[model samples]
Target: MKAFSHERAPDGKNEWLTPPEIVQALGPFDLDPCAPINRPWPTAARHFTAEDNGLIKPWEGRVWLNPPYGQETIKWMRRMREHRNGIALIFARTETRTFHECVWGVADAILWIRGRLTFFNVDGTRPKSTGGAPSVLIAYGRENAGRLHLCGLQGRITPA
Candidate 1:
């Protein structure tokens, strides 16, 4: 159970990379507006770092977002809702306000990943521990919803 908790560094960082398999399954995206340089997967043709302030940039084109998982996640979720053309990987905390506002009713489709996924570290290595919480992949547009339908991932697909 300890492993399930996304332990933060002393600096309040819960930055974990999405598994490459999940990336490959759902994408072929255009931009990873929130990717750190050390991320394991090549999320898109263009990516932005923390310094780039992806929230300020136009999230144009097919996007793949695995935004920081902290208090700032709400900002990223707001950005995604604005972009309206991408896939987002996030914790399936249905009771959270972000889920209710940003994901539950707004997303065109949602795939509740069956179990807790093991996220990678900045070094591209799998973390020794698996997350305690389950995950979700939200499709922001109809095209992405279609992609989710055909992505071959195990989950329940709910369309809005």
Candidate 2:
């Protein structure tokens, strides 16, 4: 799959965004904001940005969200709930009570991948796994439902 759109890291030295860096910053996700609208993927399937929550409004279509891995993840989770027509890639923070209450509780489908995902380099190079944490893909609506079979992540099924 393609990567998401991102500027250099806050330090301004990286120059580009990579999937692994994004996974480090966000989690195992596949959204690339810098992707051209007419790319073969049809639409943007993933977004990797710390500003994802604060900068954008509700969207309609296949969406990917790898938001910040911070306390404010809850806010982004809330927005994911609001636009229930896409997929969201998030970290499985088993230790956090808020993630359990806000994300797991509201997601339509969850995918617990078997291993840590390797996000790509800004130039599309693969990076080593950043952590041992598990990742998840939370599906929300019908279109997103069809993609679950394609992705094959394990999680309990719930009605939307």
Candidate 3:
């Protein structure tokens, strides 16, 4: 079976990048645990690409996570929850088991993006269309939650 139905990569690639605007809005992050190996821009002060096995590395300071989108996403979510000092960008699939397990009552706050996000390519190029589904920013700590609230992004933040 395919990892995720929304994965529309025809080339069997999974390196879709987050838009720079979002990062610039709520950024100056200390670490990006699941960053791409060859990114056009910096997601955080430090990054851990696939080669680093970010899931197994030590996470410090404020984190920004745009984890691999698939079954393995849960593991990354759980780690973020445990780290408790970061913000995660993920699909707004609120009813999924992953959301129930990692978000819901666990997240400090959630920002439901107003419109579909247009993820960029590894080389900083954008696709003509937006992502297949809605997206959300899940804050794991109070500081990050405040950042989300003041980020000025087009979203509705629900504090937990």
- TM for every model, in the order presented, reads 0.91, 0.59, 0.94
Q: What number of clashing residue pairs does each candidate have, in the order they appear?
A: 1, 14, 0
* Worst ten in a row by lDDT for model 3: 3-12
Task: List, residue by residue over 5-123, the lDDT tens digit for candidate 2.
Answer: 22222222332222433233322333443332222222244543335433364454545655444454566667767767566566666566546765555666666656655543444
Q: Model 3 compared with the native: what TM-score?
A: 0.94
- By lDDT, the candidates rank as 3, 1, 2
Q: For candidate 3, what's the RMSD?
A: 1.9
Off by over 4 Å in 3: 1-5, 9-12
Which digits, one per residue and each the tens of the lDDT, describe model 3 over residues 1-160? 6534568542247876888999999998999998878889999999999999999999999999998887888999999989999899999988888899999999999999999888888877887777778999999989999999999999899975
Give candidate 1 regions above 4 Å deviation: 1-4, 7-12
lDDT of every model, 2 decimals: 0.83, 0.49, 0.88
The 10-residue segment of model 2 with minimum total lDDT is: 1-10
Candidate number that wins on TM-score, 1 or 2 = 1
RMSD each, Å:
2.6, 8.4, 1.9
List the candidate 2 regions with Cα displacement exceeding 4 Å: 1-54, 152-160
- Residue 147 error for model 1, in Å? 0.6
